[model samples]
Structure formats: C-alpha cells, structure tokens
Target: VLPHDPSMRPVWMMRIGLFLYDHLARREVLPASATVDLRHGEIGQPLKPRYSKGFAYSDGWVDDARLVVLNAVDARERGAEVLTRWRCADAQRAASGWQVTLQGPGGQERSVQAKVLVNAAGPWAAQFLREHAHIQDSKTLRLVKGSHIVVRKLFDHQTAYVLQSPDRRIIFVIPYEGEFTLIGTTDVEHNGPVGQARIAADEIAYLCEQASRYMRQTVTPADVVWSYSGVRPLLEDEAANPAAVTRDYQLELDTRAAPLLTVWGGKMTTFRKLAEEAADMLAAPLGGSRGAWTQDAFLPGGDLSGWIGTAQRPDGDFQRFEQALTLRHPELSEPMARRWARAYGSRVELLLRDGLGEVVAPGLYEAELRYLHEHEWARTADDVLWRR
Candidate 1:
C-alpha cells in the first residue's frame, strides 16, 4: 500500500526512474500484481492515497545474514587470507609495504606485510585512520542511531506500510519473521560506541506512536517482542537534519607513500557495486587486477536460481528443486528436502550423501554440524547458529 501526502508528490519521478533502472539492470523491483487496491481489507485506505505497481512480498531474508559467511568462504577459496577473531593492533608505513600486526583471541600477536592497506571498518573507520594509519585531514563521519522494534503482527496480509509521521519522517512497518511486524526507525545523533547502540525509551515510544497512527491497532512498548539499534557512520554532511544526510558512499585513495584506501559510508544493498568501484580505482597502482568478474558470481548456496528445466519459468524453481530432491532421497521428508536445498543449494546431494539423521535439535542436525565444521570452519555453537 502506498501512502501519499502533499509533500511527497515529487517522489513519483523517483519511483519512475527507479522502476526504469530496475528494468535496465535485469532486476525485478516490482511484482506483476500491476496494482494494489485499497478497497480490500488487506490494505488500509490512507488519508491521501497514492498508488504503486507491486503488491507482493519477496522472501529476501535467506540470502541476507548468511552472505558474510559466503563472502569469507569465497575469499578463502580464491587464496585470500582470512583471519577471524583477530584484531588489528598496529599499522606502520614500510619501505616496500605496510607493516601490520594482528592480535588473536589468545593474546598472541602476529605481524604481516601488505602492499596496500584498506580500511573497511564501519563505525570506527575515522578513528582507525587517525590512530593507526595516521592519515590527516580525513573525511568526517556523522554517527546517527537508527532503531527498530518488532511487535506482534500488525496486519494479516502481505501489504506493508510506509508511514509518514507528523514531523515528516518516514517509518516502515513490514512483516517480519512470520509472526512479527517490524517497525522503525529513528534518526538521532549518536555519541555512544558502535556496539553500544541501544533502543532508548524515547526511541521506542516514538516508533510505537508513529506506527500506531496508521495501523489498525495501537502499538505500545508492551507489544514489542524484540528491538535493536545501530549507529550508522554516515558521511558528514552539514545538514541540520540527521535524516537528510545522504547515504551515497565515497572511495578515497591515499598514495603519498604506500597505498591506503578508505571506504566511507556505503549501504549493504550496493556493497558489491561499491567494491567494484573501489577495485577499479585501485587497479592502476596495484599493477591491475583480473577485470571485474564478480557481477554474476553466486553466493555459496544461491545457485538454486540457476537450476535447469525452469530457465523460462524460474519462478517455482525452489519448489521444483525441493520436489526433485525428495524424489532422489526418499528418506528426507518434504520439509527436510526443502530445508536441505535452501541451506546447501547444489551441494545438497553431497551434504546428504552421509545419510540423514535423527534430530540433534529442533532445526539443527548432527550431519549439518559435521558439515559446518568440516566445510564452514564452525567450531562453536554460536558460530554455527549465529553466523549462518
């Protein structure tokens, strides 16, 4: 459902441009629903209503949190050194390269040499630049706190709300995790540490008050099942409004001596594009790289989209794959087959070759634990459960 007011009429141009770009980029940004009807109780009638093209909910969560694992594994397979649970302790300019020391969890330290240094540190990028790299005149970062709360399901339909508060700020009320309605967010200046961002009493109240304006029922702090907050290190724009700060990123390369590159504010949605741009800038001085080839590379278990027999009709590929997998292995239930395909993709057969098991936990499997340790380097329960 699209919510419109007099102030947001200009967004039609942006929506058109976005749809056009999505088409040109071969990405499906809108569903084929063609229109959303407010007459249906699935969607609420807004005070000043506007219309949009899509009325579908895409299951985009499976590929999100696991992406970090996929990236680390892919990098390791490509001969890139990956050190986990290690902290960068020192960085010094050297004659041939930069001298760096990493402190491991055991309090042991190791030093390495690298021709170039990259600061992809999210919230601590500026501090790391000054303290470690000693870079001067660095770009400033405005740390803004964004918070979200998940309450009992607000609506029964797939339709979500893009609500505009009286103060003209926008908050989204999207269906989340099957049983919750996710509402957010607040834009407040943050001075706390990155990891210490917390949902303040005022932030929670603000979210509840804003979302309750349009939802069928009023939401309160008592309805919140879960909540989280993060400090976004936005590129410092001297706008008095924190929400008005632009999210566009910047890539800065310092080559006065050894090469040092720092990536400023960037969004995870465009991270691969940002990385490609960063690589393009660093290619020349670093004796060039294998020209950009990551545009079509799939994550670890994302190859399910490429299964055959559904190239022309790839919409039901996941269901079809689950069916085929069930047929191949009669031992697996339909739900288990679907889970295997989703968690392992093309590696399902290999992962199941060792035989299915009696349950180890509710959704955890003994065989899966073996797979995680043998393949994904998961040593602890948190590593397997949290990172996956």
Candidate 2:
C-alpha cells in the first residue's frame, strides 16, 4: 500500500495493519511485510516521482477461470455429474427431495431429483430462488459491478503496484499476459441484467484517471486494449459506500421442507472454506460424512510426485516436472512446454499421451484442444480461448 502523503498517521496505520497481518498466521511461503524506499529502486520506476515510499507486502494471485475448471474436473472424477450450458428451468420441493427440471441447449430438458439443492449461482442467486424455486427470500444481494481495463504493459518488472486513489479507493496495476498491464476495478452499483453487465464509459474513464495519478506514463481510455466487467453479488450490509460493503459470505439453509441452501455472497479467497462449511451443513440432511477432506487433497494436475524424483514444495516440484517434460518431449519448444506445464501441470501427460494431431492456432495444438473438449466441457472456440 502506497501513502499519498508523507503524513505519519497513514504510515503508522498501515504499519499496524501490516504487523497484524504478518503475525496473523504461520506463513511458510511468503515473507512478512516490510518498509521500502520506492524512490531508489526498480519498484518505483513506473510510478511518478511523488511516490517515494511505500510498504511492501506479499500476496498471491490465481487463475480464477482455470481454478473453476479444475474444480469441475475434480468433481467429475469423484462421480459427480458435471453439466454445462444447462440451467434449472424449474425446481419444486417434494416430500422425497427437490424435483428439478434442467433446460439445456436446443430446447432439451431433463428431470432430476436431489436430496439437497445448493444455489451458488453468484449474481443470479436471488433470481434463481424467486423465479425458479418460487421462494421469497428476505435476504437480498447488492449487485456491484467491477470493471477492469487491460492496456499495453506499463512496467517492465513483475512487481505489482497498489495505488491509493484520492477518493480512498485503491487500484491495482499488475502485469498481465506477458504483453499487457491490468488496471482495475471500479465498484459501481449495478441495476441491470447480470448477463448484460458491461464496462461503462464513465468506468473506463475513472480507471484511466486513477491509474494515471500514479503512473509516469499516463493511462487513457484510448490506450485500453480490452475491458471486462462482472457483477459481484455482495450480501446487502446497508453500507452506504459500495467499497465498504463486506466481502464476507453467508449460507442460508432452509430445511423447513426439503433442504435448500442458498449462498449469498463470497470472494474467491474464501471459496474453499465456504465449500467445506456448506458441505458440513448439508451432510446431516443428506446422510453423508461430515468429515473435511479437501485440505490435504490436491486439485487435478496439482500433484507432480508421479513425475518428479523428490516430493518437494509445489513450486520446486513443478520446475523439475517442466524440465523432465522438456527432456522427454524434445520436439516441444521452451515456451510451449512451459505454457503446457503451467496450464495443465502434471496432467499435461494426459494431453500429450496421444500425439499432437494438428496445429489449430499459433501455440495451440489439436491435442490440447481435444483434451479441453473431452475433460473440461469446452464446447466452442470462445470457451477454449477465454476459459482455458
């Protein structure tokens, strides 16, 4: 976090917060937060000269789309029926369970019964209950649209910057996709259809303005190569400021008749914990084990013990695995091998077991495309391009 001024109050407050965060848990991989002189280092090169000092902290980022795909794959491997391009047309509570009518592509419909129904439809959670299940929920969701703009790479270094705007909102300037920089996120109230959520002109200008405040190279709307927006279904907490709204989630389990669990709000950081708690809540009604098991289990392709000689840390294991893969497949280039390793991890073997048939696109092969189609439910070119 960077201080707008040299005032002692903001710096002290930040120090206290960082101290608490550093000692909050046992951090094995990341280092503790510390003070840094931004003026004399590469970290401050991209920022204006005014940003002379800031506190350096450690955090991790995830490929959210890939994470969801992996979760679906893991669920399928565990005997769960995974469906895509399907929606619950109607759901009625029965004495036995929930009778659900799922509508699929081409106007096809199928019926299924479930002992419990989990409404994790994100922004559409409330809508699903009201329209599909015909349930009147007192609890509501505050849909906040967050927008991000990707521009040509702003900095040469890998370090990400968290710039505090004059309006008290913080914006992240992070390296993205090797060729672009990602500057984001404005929190504005969304009152439109969830599917129609798109970045507005004002949002684009706001992002550019905030990003330009810190960057030596000014950002403008014309400079934006791409922009995306999504509605966050935040639990209505009555906070006047959209940014002050809590990111915490709440689970409402209605067992009055048939079990209906509705997930109100959540962020990616707490998804696993939320899932574990949700599972525990539904276990008693569904007559399943309440024991938690995901903590130790690796997601699909995360385990590299099968290929690596030593069972070391995940980063080390992955590096060794990538080297071993490159040695085994001499035909694969350095960039292609690394990309496959990072994308599929140990599961790249499954993709390569059958020889690469054709070059579908630059750096894209038929083998990988087929793997995604068969395993990850990638149906179209857009799905493969965006999701995978």
Candidate 3:
C-alpha cells in the first residue's frame, strides 16, 4: 500500500481553485510562476482544509479537458507511439513474455511481445483485461459516468462558482472559453463502451435543475450549447451510491503467470504519480534497473520560472506581452490572449515559435497543430480544436 499524507484533506477541488483565485485578485497580473517543495518519506503533516460557500474553483483555465490531452501529448513526446483506430485482439502470457495482438482498421492482424502490458485503458481496463488476459479473478473497475453542460454566461464575474448541490455533489459554474458558462456533473453508474459515452437527456435536465438552485439566471436544457460525458473508472467498492465510490487508485500486479499490471481509479491530477507506481511494480518482473522518476519533473509547457505576469520587468509588461501575441496572431482577440496565457502559461513559447510572423494557421497555429499531431497523437483536427 502507498503511504498516506495527512497534510492533505478531503477538500473539494473547487476550494483549491478558489484559493488560487483569491490569491490572484490582489495582484495586477498573475504571478509568472510558483513552486512546491516537499520532504521525502513524509506522509502526515497537518490537515487544514478550507470549508465555505460561494468560493470560485478553477485554475482560471478555459478548457479543462485539454489537460488530459496535454498529458497524452507528453506521453507521446516521451517516445510512446500512439496508434489510432487500432483495437486490441488478444493479450496473454507466453514463455518469453506477454504477447498482444492488434486488429487494424481492415481485417489485418499484427502481434507483438512485450515484457509488460499496462492497462491504462481508463473505464475499459477491466473489460480489456477480460478479453485479452485470461484472468477471471481480477479486480473490477466500476464505470461512473459524469456529465457536464455549457450554458450562456450568467455572471459578469470572471470567477467560477463551486456551489454545493443538495445531493452533496459539488457543481461548477465555470467561465468557459471566454464565451459560455460550463457547469455540470452527475455521477451515475455506467456499463458500456467508453467510446460511445455521451450526456443523456436526463443528465442535462438534472444539471440545469441543480445549477438553477444557485445562479441569478435560471438555467434550462435549451440554454446548453454543448454537453459532454466522461467515465470515471473507480475502484469497485461496496459504496451504495456511485458518487460514494473511492476516487483513490488501486494497482493489481499479475506476476502469477507473467508480469502484467492493471490500474484503476485515478484522477487527472494524480495520473503522473499513478504511472510512476505502475512502472515501479513492473520494474521487478521486467528486470529493469530504472527507479521512480516523474515526481519533480515538469509536464510539457509547464516550466515558467515566475508567476505568469509578475516578473519584475518593464512597466506594462502584461500589456506588452498581450499586444505582442495579438500582433503575431491576429486571429486571437484580447480575450483569447488572456485565455492562452492562463492555460499554456510559459508553454506559450511552444505555440508562438514563428517569431512574430503572420499566423500560419487560423484560430490556432500550424506549428501547434503539427506539435499536437506529432507529439500528442492527435489523429483529427477536432481533437485539436475541441480537446486541445
């Protein structure tokens, strides 16, 4: 079992965002950077969690789903080939190692052998294991569907709300992509193909009903311009409600036949940590000398040295940066600059590599499009526009 840190509390994610926003408001511009230092082998420190109402919760980020895509892109950057439209056929243990077969778009077949096979398939981990690995007695992965809705902006404040629902779910009325209000998420049990996930009519009605209880403007289904669904693969527990299921992760090591590691129940914030642990478990059977490594490493485009706009530089530095970006990419408005600064931060350098030249692509640039395709395994333009 992994060690627990008592310094952490059962604080909701909204509270974390509120804390950041509260800190941001006092300054003229966002800090260019901040860093966290920690002591190794330290678990319990002190538990001090914020509890209140009407607090805004967000990273001031416009597109939250892009965070997931960024990590996938990072993985590809680290030399993992991302194949598209290929489905797994059979995976089992052989004398040499685990062999996995893949079926491509057509009736073609390909097989490969690996020292370890990781089940990072999200909601389909268990199902994938059942079909590929002949492991009957395995940990079950409970698929819980969470849905969100996008509505017309209701509040003038840029801050997002983390309001409490009567059913104990925390709903976010976040300021979306500078144009709409994003709110959601109902945790309902699901058992189906993860690719076919979508927000249901009832889920839409439920979200609107819940948000209407707090906001000045009453929300209805018709106001929703967009909606989405993601399946949280929770570790199966005896919890009565799907919401009560633990978000904590569990790793099952199958060295009984060969070294196969299956992971379930992890958050976007904790995925790097999860990957490290899974890699460590496979180290023994894979005969690797490699040790855990991702803790202190920065994810792609996250290595700005100061708070975003707080560098002790020339006057109007924030304005200068925004104006420079706008001049370079005319497609981006002032609000888009604001959005890009917060989301990409120092990583904006990666997107603006043309040195103030005319924008090669519309809305976003061709360099970014190529980067997302080459490094992040983005197969389509929609993945770039929507997910990125």
RMSD list, candidates in order: 3.7, 1.5, 9.9
Which has the better TM-score: candidate 2, or candidate 3? 2
Q: Tell me, by lDDT, which candidate is best.
A: 2
Kindly list the per-residue Cα lDDT of model 3 for residues 1-388, writing each as its tens digit.
0111223323355346446655766444344222222221111111112211122122434245667666666777889776667888899788888888998978699998888788778887877877777667557778889999998877554555555666766676676766788887789888778878889999999889877765546899999998989989898898999989999998888777767777877887677788788877877887775787776565665554443344444335544565665675686667667767655655676666753345545656565666666555677767777766
User: Model 1, 213: alpha-carbon shift in Å?
Assistant: 1.3
lDDT of 1 by residue, 208-307 (tens): 9987766658889999999988788799989999999988888889898888889899877778898898888889768968878888786666576444
Ranking by lDDT: 2, 1, 3
Which pairs clash in the backbone of model 1?
A: none
| Per-candidate TM-score against the hidden true structure | 0.85, 0.96, 0.74
The positional error of residue 90 in candidate 2, measured at the CA in angstroms, is 0.3
The lDDT per prediction is 0.75, 0.90, 0.67
| Angstrom error at residue 23, model 2 | 1.2
lDDT winner, 2 or 3: 2
Q: Model 2 off-target regions past 4 Å?
A: 1-4, 7-9
Top TM-score prediction, candidate number: 2
